[model samples]
Target: MKFLGALDDVSLGRTQRCNRRLTDPNRLQAIRDTGLMDTPREEAFDRLAHLAAELLHVPLTIISLVDANKQFFKADFGLPSPFSETRELPIDASLCRYTLEGESIISSNALADPFLKFHPSTGPWGIVAIIVLPLINPEGHVLGTFCCIEPKVREWTAQELKVMRELTASIMTEINLRNQITKLKTEQNLRDTFVAALTHDLRTPLTASKLSLQLLGRRHPDMPSVQTSVARVNQSLDRAERMIQNLLDASQIQAGKHVALKLSECDLHAITVQTLEELTAVYTDRFVLKAEGTFQLMADPIGLRRIVENLASNAAKYGAPGTPIEVVLGRSGAQVTLQVKNQGNPILGEDLKNIFEPFHRSRSATESAEKGWGLGLPLVRGFAEAHGGRASVTSSAEEGTCFTITLPLDARARAQTRLELLTSDRVAPASDVSVSTRE
Candidate 1:
C-alpha cells in the first residue's frame, strides 16, 4: 500500500483555482439534465454505496454530484448525524471536488496533507483517507464522483482502485437505465389514455349512425321522416369525424407538438346559437341559450364550435333530468366569457382539485350507467388554452355547477402568449369538468 500524500501544501488560492477549474459548463449541464440532484434516495443507488463501503472495508461511501456551489449526496452509507441527514456540503468543504479534476483520486492519509487537513470532513467527521472515481456518461461528461471514506489512516491498493472503477461504471449504468425506464413508462401511459378516449368517443357516434341507418332501411323512401333520419345519420358521421380529429390533436399535444389554429373573425354568439340548435335536435328542449353584449371574436371557428359542443354535451349528460342546462355567452371589456351551467350531483372536494386533469373522471361518472373515456373536458380546455384563454369550473349544491371559459377578443395575441408559455415549460396543458344539484 503506497502512501501518496496528494493535496499537500494546497493554499486557499490554489483551492479556489481548483474549484474554478473543475466547474465545467457542459459537465454541470449534463448533471442537471439527469434530474437527479437532491432527489430522494433510491435503493439502486444506495445498494452500490453499501457494496463499495463493505467491499473496500471503509466506514463510509457516497454517490455524490458537484453542483454550482455544493456537493449533493444521491446516496451514502455510514455517514453520521447532521452530515448524513443533510446529505450535502459546501463545495469548498468537500474532497469530492478533486475527483472532478481527474479521472480518479487516492488519498492514503488525508489528515496528514496540509490542505486536506483543513477540510470540514477531515477534522469534524474524522475522515482520514478516501478513494474517489468520477462517474462519466457516454457523452464523456463527468457527472459526479463515487467515493469510499475511511475514519482511520489507510492506503488503497492497485487492485482496490480497479474494483472501485468497475463499481463506478455500474452506478452510472443504473442511473441511465432508471431514467430510460421512467420515460418509457410515461410514454406508455399517454398512449393508453389516448386509445381509451378514442375508443369511447368513437363508439357513441358510430352507434348512433349505425342505428340511424338501420331505421332508415325500414322507412319509406318518399316519406319526409326518411329525410330526417338521413340527416341524423349524416350529423353522427360528422361528429365521429370531428372526434377523430380531436384524438389526433391529443396525440400531437402529448408529443409536445403545437396545435395549429384556423384563425378568422367570427360571431361567437352565432356559433353558440347554432350549437344550441344542434343540441336541441339531438336532446330536445333540455338546454337554454343566453347571449349578451358583443359576442364577436377573432378565433378558430372550428375550435370554438368544438369547445361549445363539448361543454353543452357534458352539461346535458350530467345534469339532473328535467332541469334545463344554461349556455351563456357574454363580452366584457377585452374578454369574452362562455358559461355552461347544469344541475346534478355536486363534485367531491378531492375530485374538484384534479377535475380538469386528462383522463380524470369524477366519482359520479365512474358510478353512473353512462360510459365515457373522460376526454371531452380535456379537449374543451385544450381548445380554450390554445386560443390563449382558460377554462375553469365551480360546483356546489346551491349554484349547481358551472364551467366558464374566458378568452381574449383577439386570440392571435393570446395564441402568441400561449406559445411562449408552452415553450418555457415544455409540458402539455391539462383540462377538467363538473356539475351539481340543488339541495
Candidate 2:
C-alpha cells in the first residue's frame, strides 16, 4: 500500500539513469519464441490492454509484444493504431526496452524518460504519464507489455499499481485456463459422441435378442419355467433401453442440446388424475390424488408427467407400506401449486438441501432401497425449473414430508393455452375432441 509520491524520489532518480538497460535481448527472445505473433494471438494481449486501461483509469493502454525489428500490438485500448514501427525510431526509442531493462513495472513521466522524449505522439496524445508491466506466461516467457498511459503528470498510487499487476496476472491465468478448458471440452465431446454411437450400435443386437426371447417364450408353451426365463430376459432388455434413455437425457442436458419445449396449457387436474391412474397400476394401491381446485397451468405435459411419476415412485418405494402417496394440486392468485406428500421417515436435516443435487441420496433411503441411482430428484428439479417453476421440500420427522412445485399461470400460460387449443382442433378426431375449460 505505498501511495503516490512514496516512490517519486526513487523513480525520478531512476529516470536520470535512463540509458540503463531495463530488459535484455535474451529475455525478449524467449518471449518471442512463444510463437504468440502468428495465431489469433491478438485477443489475449488486447484483453490485457483493455483491463489495464479500465483498472488504472488511464486514457490508453496497449499490450505490445516486441521482437528484434518491430513491436506488434497484441491488444490496444484507446490507441489510434494496432502497432508502431520500430524502424521509424532510433534504438533508444522503444518503451518496452525500458520494460525489458527493468524486468518490472515501469511508471514514469514520458517527458522525463529521455528515451521517449523524441516520440512524435508523446505530447500530442497528451501522454505525460505511463506505466508498463510484462505479460509473462507460465513458462517464464515475457510475451508482451501491459501498459497504461495518462494525459497529464499524475501520481501513480502504489495501491493502484499493485491492483494493476494483480489484474495482469489474473488475465494471463484466465487466458491459459480458458485455452485448457476449451481443449478438454472438445476431447470430452468426442469421447461422448463415440460412446453414444457405440450404445446405439449395441442396442440393435439387444433388441434382436429381446425379440428372439419373446418368440421362444411364445413357441415353447409347454415349458412354463422356460417361458418365465424368456420373460425375464425381455424385462432385462427393457431395463437396458430405459437406462440408455436416461444416459442420453443426461448427456443432452450436459451438452445443452435438448430440444426446446413445445409448451402448452395442460389441465393440471387431468395431468394429476392420469398420472395417478398410471402409477396405481404400477405401484398397486399406493397412489392417491387429493384435489383442492380445478386449475389449468402452463407446462410441457410430458415433462410434468415425468416429474410427478418420479415423486410418486420415490414415495411408494420408501414410505410405510399402507401410507397413501398424496398428489395435491391447487391454484392461488397467479400461481399453481402441486405437492406430493408421503408418510415416510423424514430425511435428515443436513441431507435435504443436497437431495436435489445430482448423484446424491439420503443415508436412510440408501439403506432401505436396493435399486436407485440418485438421479430422480435432480431430473425432476431440472424439468420443473425449465418450465419456469421451482421445486422445494418440507419435512419433519413426526409429520412425514411433502415436495411442492409452483408455476405461474399468467399471460405466458394463457398464450400457451390458446396454442394448445388450436393444435388440438387440428389433430384430434371429431369424436375425441372437446373444448378446453380455460379461463
Candidate 3:
C-alpha cells in the first residue's frame, strides 16, 4: 500500500536531513573524513546484530546510527541496503528519538500506528511488526539503535525484551570502545602531524650539515677521521627518523587504525615467488618457502609481504647467520597457516609468554645490540588478529624458534565462488577440504 512507500520516503528524507546536519557544508567534509568503521569493529557489530535478530525472531536486524539528518547502518542483516537516507522525518518522528525520550523500547504494530500509516515499508515487505532498542552508553548518550523488523505481527514478551536489552548492552560496550578509539585517533593524528612538522624543521638543519660535511670530505680527502665523524652524525639523524616513524606506527595500532587488504585469490606458489623475489636483496643466504598445492588464499599482497619481511628480518638478526630460514604455508579444511622457522638460541621458557607484547624484548635474544624498540612482534600480532587469526612463537635451544600465524579464509565469499566446483565435480565440499601439514 501507499503506507509502505510513504514510510520509505519518510525514512529516506529523514536520513538525508540528518546527514546534512551532521555533515553541514563545511562539517560534511570532516564527518566524511572520520572513517569510524574498520573491519574488526564492523565484524563485531555484525555479530551483535545477528544475536539481536536471533533473539527477536525477526527477519531483519540493523544497528543504525540515527544522526540529526540521516540513518546510517553500522551493520545490518536481511536488509536490501546496509545504508539509506531518511531525511523525510524530523527528529521528533524518529523511533530512535523516542528511545531518548525515556522509552526503554520503541515497538510498533505497523498496521495500528498512525505515525507509520503512510510508511509503505511495512505492507509491501510483509513487515507488520518493528522494534528499535536504543544503544545507550553508560554516560547516558544514545550512540545508535538496534532495530528488528518482522513480517508477522507478534507480541514481544518481557523475556524477549530482556534478551534484546542484554544484546544492546554489548552493542553499547562496542560503541563505547569505538568512541574511545575515535578520540585516541584524533589526538594521535594531531600528534603525528605536529611531529612531522617538527621533524621536517629539524631535518633541514641535518641535511644542511650533511651537505657541508660532504664539501669538507672532498676538501680534505687526506683526513679520514673527519669523514668518519660526519658519517656518524648522519647515521644518528637517520636513526632518529626511523624511531619517529616507529612511534607513529605504534600510535596507529593504539588508535585501531588498520591497513585494508587488497585481497585476491592467488595461489600460494605465486605469493611465495613474489615474497622470495623481494627478500632476495636482504636475505641472499638460505631462504626457503615450501608448499604442497596451488591452494589459493585471499590476502593483501602488501600486508602479507610486511608480515613475511618482519619475520624474515627477525630471523636474520637473532638467528645464526648463513643458517636456513624456512617458510611454509599449509592448509587444513577451512584454515591456512604460515610459519617461519630458523636455527637460533631457542626462546627460554620464561620469555615465550611476553614476546608478543609491545616494547618487550626477549631476555634470551642475543641481538639486543641490534636496534629495535620491541614493537615488531606486537605489530605482527596486531596484523594477524586483524585478519581474524593469531600469531604464535615457540622455541627451544635445540630446535631454535618458529613463529606461526594462522588465518581463516573468508568462508562465505569462498563458498560463493566455489559452489560450481562443489556442485559439478566430485570435489570435496569446501567445508571438507582439509590439508594438514606442519614444519
Candidate with maximal lDDT = 1
On residues 164-242, what C-alpha lDDT tens digit does candidate 1 reach at each position? 8889989999878866877776886788587667777777867777776867756767777777768767776777777
Candidate ranking under lDDT, highest first, comes to: 1, 2, 3
Better lDDT candidate (1, 3): 1
Scored by TM-score, the top model is 2
Once superposed on the true structure, which residue ranges of model 1 sit more than 4 Å away at CA? 1-128, 131-145, 148-229, 253-258, 417-439
Rank the candidate models, highest TM-score first: 2, 1, 3
Give candidate 3's whole-model lDDT: 0.64
Per-residue lDDT over 253-303 for candidate 3, one digit per residue giving the tens place of the 0 to 100 score: 655543233455545557666866766766685788878765566655445
Model 2 pairs in collision:
21-101, 22-100, 22-101, 22-102, 23-100, 23-101, 46-75
Q: What are the runs in model 3 whose C-alpha is more than 4 Å off? A: 1-247, 364-367, 411-439
Q: TM-scores for all candidates?
A: 0.55, 0.62, 0.41
Backbone clash count for every predicted candidate, in the order shown: 4, 7, 31
Question: What lDDT score belongs to each candidate, Candidate 1 first?
Answer: 0.78, 0.67, 0.64
lDDT tens digits by residue: candidate 2, 69-103:
44566557786632333212233445564454336
